[model samples]
Target: MTDSESVRQDTHPSGTWDDIKELPPSAKLVAKVLEHNEAMTQQTIAEETLLPDRTVRYALNRLDEKNTISSSFSVMDARRQLYTLDINP
Candidate 1:
């Protein structure tokens, strides 16, 4: 499809995340944040990516469930969870 056609076909504002443009809107937002940063807490990603905390949480959870990335808490904040791309154990 042409760029304009794609625009018409696309359902949401896009390119917020390079790896996520083709993903569903919510997933796209989260993917963008992950792609742009080495790692990010779910909350920080929620803020930077302009998605709700629950949405960010859900997306992160899905990516983790898929084994696309791994997650752990920061040394400083047990409450803060960081997600990083999974290249293998």
Candidate 2:
């Protein structure tokens, strides 16, 4: 399998500690929130985590860069996006 596939198969909400160990505190916090909750929008995340919108946005960007999360346009609101962990494991 390719490297990306390998990483996916080895990661999940419950199994992402290792994968996120090197990430910053904000990223880790964002990841944990995603782990416990289902798909969430950036605003929802900020509310739930009590983090600033800018911080949450930065964390989400970091997670996205790490291939640890994925996002899709929200069905309820076309202008908003829903985020979820890329946990296949």
Candidate 3:
């Protein structure tokens, strides 16, 4: 398997990506960005994925519904929230 595949498997032995497979393409993209970056705000995710803010927000909501990602208010900026993968990819 490729390195990315290995990482995906490592993220969740049962297969987090497998769970994500049914989600929207935008959600998958957002998950990938979070996997690589570890943690970031919605704006950063949008910048990294080159997706619009609304699209990113929608993706985040989808991920949230699946319990795939976690978020906490940024210590430096309470108005912003830092998002991270709950699955540890």
| Best-fitting candidate, scored by TM-score | 3
Candidate 2 Cα misplacement greater than 4 A, ranges: 1-16
- lDDT of candidate 2 at residue 82, scale 0 to 100: 78
Scored by lDDT, the top model is 3
The TM-score between candidate 3 and the true structure equals 0.79
Q: Which stretches of candidate 3 lie over 4 Å from their true place?
A: 1-15
Candidate RMSDs in Å, in order, are: 14.4, 8.0, 8.2
RMSD of 3: 8.2
- Candidate 3 per-residue C-alpha lDDT over 6-87 given as tens digits, one digit per residue, 9 for 90 to 100: 2221132223666788999999999988888766889999999999999999999998877787777665666777777776
* Per-residue lDDT over 25-48 for candidate 1, one digit per residue giving the tens place of the 0 to 100 score: 676567656766776777788888
Q: Write the per-residue lDDT of candidate 2 for residues 1-89, one digit (tens) a residue.
A: 11222212133343345677788899999998988876788999999999999999999988877778877766556677778777546
Comparing 1 and 2 on TM-score, the stronger one = 2
Q: CA shift at 69, candidate 1, in angstroms?
A: 1.5
Give all TM-scores, in the order shown.
0.64, 0.77, 0.79
Instruction: State in Å the error of residue 56, model 3.
Output: 0.2
Model 2 gets an lDDT of 0.75
Ranking by TM-score: 3, 2, 1
